[model samples]
Target: MKYVNEAYDFVNHAWSKGKIKKLIAPLEGLAYCTTVKGFKEVGLGVQPEESNYFNFFYPKGRFHDSLYGDDFPAEDLVSDCICEAVKQYIEGANSEFQVPFVRILIDLMSNPRFTYLRDGETEKKYVHVIPDDDNAYLLALRGEFLAKFHFGNKSDADDEYRAEFTSEEIDEMRKMSDLAIDWSKVNYESA
Candidate 1:
């Protein structure tokens, strides 16, 4: 849960500096700003080094600084979208335990958001996030689905045998996760 602490630290620092409000402003539709703040409070010291802590919450981007800039590219403007989506989903999940580190790593790689820049123009940059519930939820669902699929047989550890699933299978799973999240209404009001 070290990375949880890191997430908390990141948010807490922002809060102390009066930036948490702006950081989560885009999440108003997905979850209340206060609720998102509360989520960060509980996440304090949870896991300080988990990669998803960054990918899910902070993401790989410069969008955070864009709030003060003028005219960000459409595709480079969704970091907040990704972070809020991830934080809200993690909060909604019924589990108190952390996703395995390996799974988290896989999620960082296999998630489609990591592969394509927002407009497919930039070469895999994480400048901005889409900041939409559908996009965020789809990203999370894709992470979870990939974990369930490629992450089987944890002990196999053989690098060569690791590459079994096809790009088609991965795409199919992503589609399914997106559909599930799209049709999902139970707990939709909470976040």
Candidate 2:
């Protein structure tokens, strides 16, 4: 498909520019959001008018219709193309980097908090916070989570969603969350 070719071109150009490292976080985030949170589609676009950086878009619902009009590819098609593109990139990555990248992906996949969003919402009612007893605590926690991770800002939050985990577990979740940011831009020629 044309979208598949375009995705491959985008990834290959990133590889050539020595900027693929910047894509690691965004790609993993896309994968996590789709496979884990049930997002319909995710895309990488270079916004020259804005930051000139590649941004990942996983629109909540009909948002894509307004953004891309009727010409946008099917959701499943785009998802498959993204998966294929990521696979090809990982396969072609340097061995040293590949090992650590795979490790990070594995850790991320194993962490339930990495896929905290439900039905495209990360707010109070949508997020699955445990021990739903303390309303004030839940509101504060949700606010912190959204502010730090959702609003493109970074800040610490108490893990009151459940019984607190060990230090190591918390560290792993923090690392993955930190890596979940906007994709970095790349130079690619569309064929």
Candidate 3:
């Protein structure tokens, strides 16, 4: 349970700082130790003097000692468990939401005549806003983007999808898109 708590804290710290890359080494090490050959390679081989009361007749080997020894930090054990959980969460979010949302945004951005329909009806559609519309266009785009992305489904359900992305990530996406649009506008005007 102590190891589990430590693992939870480690994951939270890494996630908060957007340092998901830090989990890679532990994940790789866990992967490497899954096979018998890998276990033998990584494991601290046979120890002769180590004997538990239950196994007094038969002393523990190097592999057993390596696992139970004080030298093996609790961090390593919990890291493997936490890293697997994080990996699964990322995969699920990517497949279920992120990829689809990005694809929909890209498709919409490429089409000049694209309109976001609040309902499936023409009367409820939101067409591209004019330059004089102030923030109306951005609001429309956000609504349409969220609608098309089906983000409402997850947003209504305790916002589990929001945990998959950091605020910086969302901001970066907006910044990049704005920069690209500004560049395009300047080039179009010059030409």
Candidate 4:
């Protein structure tokens, strides 16, 4: 059975933290390939709007590779894994999306499954931190303890432990973020 509280925590952090923007803040106007969350091939654009908030854009389905080291796209044949970013894929996407790109990458990076299988141990219960589409962080369990950090895709089983955003929640966040963002901070440019 899926744990609701765990899922909620994961999503809360994933939604609230601006991981993508934090990571991308340093790489303005750079061209790079992406494979995070099934998004492929990306080039991020950042320019401040009249209100002083930065406007970020990328192809409809693209993410940064390095920022999503843990959950970057896998080779599985299954297709179509859209996240909240999809809303911004449209031309002139709202500035509210400016934060999630980085947060999503941060969440994806947090899900690591490096096992420390011992020679004399078996059936050990383990726990892990995982992030999901709904922008939540949750705990993942395994037969044994594993390191919290790694650089590879997780098993199919791990996919089941994710949370998702309801259309309502996405809209709520979008609206809330629009109010919470302090545009003045986004006015500065990188050297």
**Top candidate by TM-score:** 2
TM-score of each: 0.17, 0.20, 0.19, 0.16
Report how far off residue 156 is in candidate 1 (Å).
Answer: 58
lDDT of 4 by residue, 49-124 (tens): 2232221122332332332222222211111111222222222234554544445434433334211223323222
Using lDDT as the measure, what is the rank order of every candidate, best first?
2, 3, 1, 4
lDDT of 4: 0.28
Over 4 Å off in model 3, which ranges?
1-5, 10-17, 25-33, 38-47, 50-63, 66-191
Candidate 1 ranges beyond 4 A from true positions: 1-77, 89-94, 100-110, 113-191
Worst 10 residues of 4 by lDDT: 73-82
RMSD of each: 20.8, 18.3, 26.5, 24.6
lDDT of 2 by residue, 1-191 (tens): 22333444545555553454454435533433323233323222211122121212334421122222222333433345454545555575766545444454455344432222345332212111222223211111222113122221123253332222233433443467454422232111111
Candidate 3 per-residue C-alpha lDDT over 1-191 given as tens digits, one digit per residue, 9 for 90 to 100: 22333334434445532544543433444323432221211112222222310111111211222223222432343344454454444555536445432343244333432222232121111211234433222211122113111112223333322112223433454465332333222111100
What is each predicted model's overall lDDT from 0 to 1? 0.30, 0.33, 0.30, 0.28
Clashing residue pairs in all predictions, respectively, total 20, 1, 2, 11
Say which candidate scores most in lDDT: 2
Runs with alpha carbons beyond 4 Å of true place in candidate 2:
1-67, 70-78, 81-85, 99-191
lDDT accuracy of residue 8 in candidate 1: 41
Model 4 residue 45 lDDT?
23
